[model samples]
Target: MVDQWKAPSAAEPAVGDDKSWKLLEKTLLAGVQEQRRARRWGIFFKVLTFCYLITVLVLFTPLLDMERTAVSGSGYTALIDVRGVIADKEEASADNLVTSLQAAFEDPKVKGVVLRINSPGGSPVQSGYVYDEIRRLRGLHPDTKVYAVISDLGASGAYYIASAADEIYADKASLVGSIGVTAAGFGFVGAMDKLGIQRRAYTSGEHKAFLDPFEPEKPDETKFWQGVLNVTHEQFIASVKQGRGDRLKDKEHPELFSGLVWTGQQALPLGLIDGLGNASSVARDVIGAKELVDFTVQESTFDRFSKKLGASVAQQLAMWMGFQGPTLR
Candidate 1:
């Protein structure tokens, strides 16, 4: 080799370099293909999950309605739940209650209807609507008696609804009765003054902005608002009298309509409730229909999920903004 003294050929190094480059290129292509396959699988699983959820929702919706229709041959007591605030869009709203009542009344197998109540009350207007409907339905279906059984708390609008029943019952410790109207809101004037925030609201009418919490409360407006509440209270009193009839022991009791909540034991003497019992006892002993079937209109699964997601946030926002109106409770 020394005698020859020839340099190594350049093609030898080029051939090794080309082989290394080809190996690197093959590795990169394999990696890219693997990533593409993973991405495709991820998309497929996501679509599969979406389709599963949709199928579940579709199947669940009919089952809710089917519950109302699946009455037994043996007569059963129809149970309608009035749990929570009795306002529009609430679970125990007038519309839902009315629908449930109508369904129970329509079903021939339904021996009696029981309103299972556990609420602190809500809108007077909504309560009034339900009250009227109950009376109307009672007239339409005299044999199907409606009973209200308060579990925990049934005051204000809840009481208003219970009064409409043929008979009202509750546990001895249950809270009952709050026959009055109330409108509450936060006055932000002091807070705004401290924060140096001037609220500029333009309006056409003189009393258009009377309830504006940012402004100083006027004596005249306050008087007018009280008058409105008084009128609503009077209407509530009249309805209660109509519903309870002569069962109300003392119609002129000073604290009776002063929005005082009482225990079931105390309410019995006041004629607010007929007896002490729960939904089961009322259904079995009172109605003589031991078998129970729920007639409550339930919210769809998707709607319930969406409400759970957004309801709390929206409620907090409303409270912070001081957006309020007259509520029966």
Candidate 2:
């Protein structure tokens, strides 16, 4: 009777229940902390790997350039490439070309300079800048002759640059010459009208938004824009004539500056190209230097990557918005 019945107190938990709960909570907490630690380590390792790669790239690029310079040796033909659109930030830009030309001319080891061009052409302003620089550099270094060798295609602004060379050469099948200026954009006025949309563009001046694609075509504005293109075309033609110095057969072919492209063979008879040859042929036979050394100004890998990541988006946006200037194409 004494071993029998004293009721359990309500304040007390069941035997082992409290201890089991405490153990479970501790296990959960430890697991969460461990997971967090692993995540932090993963991030750290990823950052470390990225830094290592960048360091290796930065350290080795200069060494590669030095090796190229050593291989160039004492005397060689300096080759500057003009490949792609001749725009402000492009590979064939005025700044890059001028810098390359300067480096080539300043070097006593450079017997001659060759501009290897393969472009469909781009900005007239950039081309003009390069043309002016080439002339100035030629005056400064009369011994180092600058020759342009057109590869696959050299038209419009590209031809403009080539004309500045002492003598222009091209492959017999190469496309050359397109001495013209054009400003092109899409007209969204009709499309907007069809879609029952009204364009409301505010501007300080009346003709300020004349070239706006969302606006209706005004006859007066059209005439004014044509006049602007005509003026730019005239300037381009004048530069070519000045550079070629009577080599152009404009008298026989009035359509020479009508934006028509010609093959290298056709260009020779028409006085567009002086000779038919490639970069190697010109280097060996013309410059008398069989060993050709590249003097093209190349952007570093990091610079290229950064630009593509940043500026390319903005450039595409500007183009899509129809805000374009005169192009020599």
Candidate 3:
């Protein structure tokens, strides 16, 4: 027993101890190999998923096959959609519409351009800009005709832009015109008095707070604003007259420009619309283009998502910027 207590030999260890060390080393090596294999597979699947997503996105967007969809040797008709409120920074803004119109007209394969409108109305200034640009573009490309085709409704500022087109078409039951100008705001003075609330505001100019909702109504301000609306309405009537010329039956309809909306059937006699036809039939029979190429500027998916996420923030920003006026709705 005393001899067995001596230290193990340095040259050679016991059989059992040597075997245990060899097994431990082998297990660790196998574990490292398995981990490496798992990591490689994970990286491969991630790259494959990324590639699949990219391919799907490309197929979904128009940019994928623009040449095939837009133009061919037979020629095509360009369609620019004017939908929703025609505000400065909105989807139907003058900048986007005008840009789309220019591109459509400039394309040689496009024999004609169509302004497809479906809107209530919006800012007069934005509509004016789009109207003027369309006129200018027509002058530049005299050979390429521009037609406005109203869907269910095209009124107010929408009609302003449509008037500039070479011809305006609409469905028989469509609401064609609302040529007018208006500005609307509320007066909260009476409500505040009933609630026993006091309003405080400071402005540099005496009339700067003239349109404040919480302040008492001012007779002079109301008169002044009514006059402003009348002036703008007059401008709208003048533009329509200039655009329509002899086609308009002004004698028969005295209230044609009095913010009166008319059906497409009534609009024909009023010279508010030229004919009744949908975009497809007009493209096929009128323009002689079976293939229709839409030239509308669509907002990106990310941009729409961001707008939804920041809606409250946008409202706050708009509130800070006061007195947005000259609206044609």
Query: Against the true structure, what is every candidate's RMSD?
Result: 7.4, 6.7, 9.5
Q: Write the per-residue lDDT of candidate 2 for residues 113-194, one digit (tens) a residue.
A: 9999999999999999999999999999899899999999999999999999999999999999998988888998788989
* Candidate 3 colliding pairs: none
Worst 10 residues of 3 by lDDT: 320-329
Mind sharing the TM-score for model 2? 0.84
What overall lDDT, based on C-alpha atoms, would model 2 receive against the true structure?
A: 0.86
Give, for candidate 1, the lowest lDDT window spanning 10 residues.
Answer: 320-329
- The sequence of per-residue lDDT tens digits that candidate 3 reaches over residues 9-115 is 88878759878998999999999999999999999996885566456446664453454453676799998899999998887999889889988887888989889
Query: What are the TM-scores, per candidate, against the unseen true structure?
Result: 0.81, 0.84, 0.76
Give a tens-digit lDDT track for model 1, residues 23-84: 99999999999999999999999688657656865887677656545657689999989999
Q: Which candidate would rank higher by lDDT, 1 or 3?
A: 1
- Model 3 scores a TM of 0.76
Runs in model 1 lying further than 4 Å from the true structure = 1-24, 47-71, 301-329
C-alpha lDDT of residue 170 in model 2: 97
Residue 233, candidate 1: Cα error in Å is 0.7
Worst 10 residues of 2 by lDDT: 320-329
Candidate 2 has which clashing residue pairs, if any?
A: none
| lDDT against the true structure, each candidate | 0.86, 0.86, 0.83
TM-score of 1: 0.81
